[model samples]
Target: MATPPSEYAMSRTPHFQELRMASGSDNLQGCFHLLFTQQYAEIDGLINVLCEKRDDLFKKIERMEKLVEEGEGLCAFHDSGNVGLEFMKETLKTDKKVLAALTGLLDMACEGRREKRRHVSRFE
Candidate 1:
């Protein structure tokens, strides 16, 4: 399983803390902006990794379907091939939703950053 971006971000706290410590109060905001930018990059990477995992799972499902079709209607691993198929379908559906939520989160975060930049630029 892939580690979530939020959880992975925690591991980067020390680096951000170092940046904060190195900066004066006036530059605190700049440090935070950098943090957000780095986080966006990480989230983007996470999305790519998840998409790859999803693709691999889809390939596995195709292989499983072929195997079940060749075998008697019953699955050796699962009680019935049909049941296993339905299970994988449902699992994929759930994963699809999760991926959508993650993408939405990334979109919202990016939008917020853009808005903040616009607001700041107007004053400068």
Candidate 2:
């Protein structure tokens, strides 16, 4: 019997934590702008990682579906597959929403850095 993926696989990855830490520090306006740029880069990396994970998740689901079909409508490993399938559905939805939020944050951060540059240029 093939074991399903652990929920930990869908957890906040290491890059995610690094981004949080990088974005939380206080510094000068110039330094903050640099950090924000770095944050955007990190966010892009995180998004790519998430996309890969989501692809893997979908493949896992497909395998599960095949197993169920092979069982001829009865999952011998468990009484029913509904619980696991529903959980995966919810996880996928949550993952997508998180990605959307991260994208929005990246956009906001980029705009903020641009505005800061504008302010500095105007003062010079």
Candidate 3:
């Protein structure tokens, strides 16, 4: 059977109010702790990702250096071909353009590497 509201039920009963307060406090504490724990976990994950990105950038720089070295070797070989320099002056001019283009590309690659390092450093 349903009971009618007592004076204590309609008003703030001390015992019931204290129980509610205690439970609320406990719940609030648990929520704050969980929030802090999640924040720490996210921070750790971000650090790991940053480290991996830095490693990847370093690998890219290594690859670019290798490419530049290979390009330089090819340019050297072209310049050293059997034909006399005077006879191939026009051809050498075209070769110079190719070398210049390769150099510009290498410069861009180096700049990209530098920018990546800067970005990764800031994240760290």
Clashes of 2: 0
List TM-scores for all candidates, in order.
0.44, 0.39, 0.38
Judge candidate 1 against the unseen true structure and give its global Cα lDDT, from 0 to 1. 0.58
Stronger candidate by lDDT (1 vs 3): 1
Candidate 2 residue-wise lDDT, 1-124, digit = tens: 3232244732645554344345553323433455556555665575566566656656665665565456544444575666665655566566566656655665665566566556555433
| Candidate 1 lDDT, 1-124, residue by residue in tens | 3322354654677665566555432354666665555555665676566567656666765665566465535554666766776766676566566656656765665676566565445433
Cα displacement (Å) at residue 88, model 2: 0.8
Give the 10-residue window scoring lowest on summed lDDT in candidate 2. 1-10
For each of the candidates, the C-alpha root-mean-square deviation to the true structure, in angstroms, is 12.1, 18.4, 17.4
Cα error of candidate 2 at position 113, Å: 0.7
Q: For model 1, what is the alpha-carbon lDDT of residue 19?
A: 66
Best by TM-score: 1
- Which 10 residues in a row give candidate 1 its minimum summed lDDT? 1-10
Q: Compute the lDDT of residue 123 as modeled in candidate 3.
A: 36
Candidate 3 Cα errors over 4 Å, as ranges: 1-25, 76-124
Instruction: Tell me which residue pairs clash in candidate 2.
Output: none
In candidate 3, clashing pairs total 0
The positional error of residue 60 in candidate 3, measured at the CA in angstroms, is: 1.3
